[model samples]
Target chain A: MIDYQLLDALAAIVSEKGFEKAAKKLFITQSAVSRRIHQLESMIGEPVLIRKQPPKPTAIGKRLLNHLQQVRQLEVALSIRSLADENLQDSPLTVKLAANADSLATWLPEALMLPKAEKVCDFRFEIIAEDQSIALKRMKAGEVMVCICSNEEPINGGLVSALGAFRYKVIASPNFVKRHNITSVEQLTELPCLVYDEHDKLQHQLLNELNKSVPKYTHICPSSEGFKQAMIAGLGYGLLPTLQLGDAIEQGELIDLVPGYFIDVPLYWHYWQTESPQLKSLRNFAIKVASNKLETLA
Target chain B: MIDYQLLDALAAIVSEKGFEKAAKKLFITQSAVSRRIHQLESMIGEPVLIRKQPPKPTAIGKRLLNHLQQVRQLEVALSIRSLADENLQDSPLTVKLAANADSLATWLPEALMLPKAEKVCDFRFEIIAEDQSIALKRMKAGEVMVCICSNEEPINGGLVSALGAFRYKVIASPNFVKRHNITSVEQLTELPCLVYDEHDKLQHQLLNELNKSVPKYTHICPSSEGFKQAMIAGLGYGLLPTLQLGDAIEQGELIDLVPGYFIDVPLYWHYWQTESPQLKSLRNFAIKVASNKLETLA
Candidate 1:
């Protein structure tokens, strides 16, 4: 049987991303952390960590991490059941959730705000900002307890539920529209387009449907607000969530390049089947908030 | 002599992160792109790109990329100089910049608004969000031409200048303050702290200065706005930019755990010494805009 203490050392090293930091976090000596990892390696008869600037786990190491995280979920549920005496007040559980930036820019904050209304304030969350395409991979790697992603597929031992959907419309500043005189599909290929990054293909997918050629010029802004600001500044034109446009379209600050056309992006909440009761209810609350704010796919 | 076409193929492959995408971007067949890379590899006597799912360039390949990007910078300068009679109106130059998320969350948007004020809008920008420590690494690898970082040391063939500064204050929501009764440094360690990510040492550094122990609980939010929202939601206390904390603290929604105490973060612009005239002027405009908005380091 593997010692759980050794596994905790490995988890801490990966979580903190360094031995020194892991030692600080675990309140142990740096060498002690190293010794625990070495003992684990000796027990398994294989090295678990790749010795790099910030170390990464080997394949078997990743499997170990996944198992430990699931076990942790069970422990968290037990703790929540024992919260009746208010024993777990000071010790807030650190939970990680992976969500795309676009959702975070609009309705996810409101979903997170549900905890405040319910008076469930015993959790500290790390909202990992990731592209929807990559968020599920992070969850599969056991890096997060819950994920808000576009992929509907559930990982092994995971449960997924529909979190409603959002629609994106092509938008540009009034000054940009007037400057470029964008009137047709061909003109859009000629004008500059903005994207979150190369992984972000909303612009590419939309443009391919309209024109044969990819965007002649592209701008990549990795931040949600920054991308919108870039759009509002007449830097380039690209897709924006209709929910986030708020008054930009009506106030004449932004023009929907394609008024009726939209690409609906449906979101799914992917959580561990063994997710703690607190996070499970939080996930349900998120779905409730999302359904209230976002349009239904049906 | 090595062919510039081969180098361009290598660049497009890396920029687009795949051969198929590079083929589309370069308006060449995939085989033609492959042949160019093979030719370049034969010339270098080493593999330029690793054949992974998303290809990565070798170290020597990075040196070659740095060289080509510099050449491209010169070409852009030439194009701008020859921009008489609006000849180059249709073709916009693509520029990549690396920035810390904190700036993007605050005054960077204002700084980016300069081009519109000056009627200079022929460039497309891709702002790569990264931690300040890691931003320089990407810039050094020639992933970006211009970088906004906290690093003071100038890289080879790079120019550095002050881009003003900002201050951070330790704050929490009024409810968090009341619930935790955080009146002393001891109480701080007892409460949870928030950091941008594992790469973010701002919270740890501040707490290390205040107390010998690291934060007992550290929540990591990777996005700028998400991090602030996590703080505002009373998930944890953290170091937030004073500029971003405006109204939240004054409006009685937040309380400064350390009143009048602050950590000033100075920013510097790191651009290539061979920066184009167009970009140089834009960089100067950013500096001017930043100076007007951000506080002086002194």
Candidate 2:
């Protein structure tokens, strides 16, 4: 059996980036931390960390850290169960989740504001906003407890739920529409297009459906908020999430380029197959709220 | 001497997260990719990757990848210098940078729009929006070529420049201010505060300056845009960046709480000491633009 304390020390070293900082966090001496790491390495019969300026974990160390995190989650669940009647007021839970940038900027806040999600207040959330592909990869790597992603297929031993579709409409500032006189699909190639990034194919996907290729000039704004702001400021035209554009569109700040043409990206929720009440509560709340917010395809 | 081809294959595998996908990216067979990785491990006399579902690089692998990226950058610089008269239109340079979210949302855009920065159109930019601490860490790790951060100290073998300061003021929606009747610092604890995240100390920093503790109720909106929107929607008060708040305040959407109390966070630019013309151009352009945009300290 592996000693969890030694594993914890190894994880701390990687996360805190040094033995001294890890020792400070763990409230132990640096020598104690080093000894624990050494013992763990001896037990595994291999060095688990590179003692560089900022120490990094080896592949075996990463596996050990991953195992430690899983064990920690189980322990937290056990503690919560044991103290069921204590209301969990004193001990606040921390939930680490991976999500796409668009979701975080749009309906996610409202979803978290749902009455059932008030429990979210009792928890600290570490949200890692990333592209859908990267988010899914992080989820599969056990880096996050849950993920809101575009991947429909669930990972092995994980629960997956359909959270409806996020519809994106090709939109631009009202001024940009008037200046460019963009009415037909062919004119789109003449005007500059705004893309989220190189890997972002939303603009291309829409253009491909309309049998149009990407324009020569394109502005890439990586942040979802920056992308919207750039569009609002008449930087270029691109697909904006319907949920995020409702207010802007209503205020006439943004105008849909081609009416009745939109791309609906199906989103899914994936969580670990665990008996943790907090995870179950969050997953159910998210699905319920996302279902209400996102467009449902019949 | 390390084989850059094998190193590239290893980096691709770690980044793409799968052997098949890495193979596809390199335009090589999956078996060939595996053989290169095997050869690299044999050459290094140690395994360089963990064969997990989503493969991860070992410490040695990570160092090798970092070295490979640095070498690639130098090679690109050499090629650019040799083809100086070719106008660099055919070959687009890529500059990876790290910056705070607030900078990305506000002044950074205008800085990128500067006349000198028009040449930036020739380069592809990968701007990673992260906190100052994390940004500094990534710079130190050599993951990013340059970073806009709060750290004034230059990293070893790097250059640092002061980019003036970003001023933040306590701001609330007009309705929220009227509803709460917040006139004194003592009443601040009664109202709910909006924070970007737990790491965000702007609110706390302001409160600390005024000798006040944090409120009992606080709302965490991690995104810079979301934080501003939440304030505009009367969710809670927050320390809004002066650059972002100008339009909102002028439009009467948000009101400043204290007339004089504002915090100015000094920002610095850190980049590698390199003879690369692209790096020099970017550094000079960024410094010139940021100096003009940010508030200079007397």
Best candidate according to DockQ: 1
What does chain B score (TM) in every candidate? 0.95, 0.89
Over the stretch A62-141, how does candidate 2's per-residue lDDT look in tens digits?
A: 66765666777788778876777486654556667777878877766545433532453255456677787568766655
| Tens digits of lDDT, candidate 1, A127-231 | 888899889988887878889999999998888999988888999998888888877867998788888986899998988988867887887789877777778
B1-298, model 2: which lDDT tens digit per residue?
Answer: 8788899889889768899999999999999999999999999999999787578777777677656656776787788767774867544566677888888777665454324334633555567777865678666655677789887898766789888898888898888787778778777775677777656877777776775676555776677776776677676787888887757888999998887888888888887666366676766777887888788954
Model 1 TM-score relative to the real fold: 0.85
Which residue ranges in model 1 land beyond 4 Å of their true spot? Answer: A1-64, A78-86, A113-121, A182-186, A208-214, A246-252, A255-261, B1-3, B23-51, B79-86, B113-121, B181-186, B208-214, B245-259
**Residue-by-residue lDDT tens digits, candidate 1, B1-298:** 6689999999999988899999999999999999999989988999988776578788888888988888889987776767652755566667788999888767775576555456344677888999987798877888889889888889998889998887888988887787677679767876878778768888878888888768888776777766666677676788988877768766887788888788887899998988987787788888998898788978
- DockQ scores for all predicted structures: 0.46, 0.18
Per-structure clash totals for the candidates? 0, 0
Residue A266 of model 1, lDDT score: 87
Each model's iRMS: 2.2, 3.5
- Cα TM-score of candidate 2: 0.70
Q: What share of the true interface contacts does candidate 1 keep?
A: 0.50
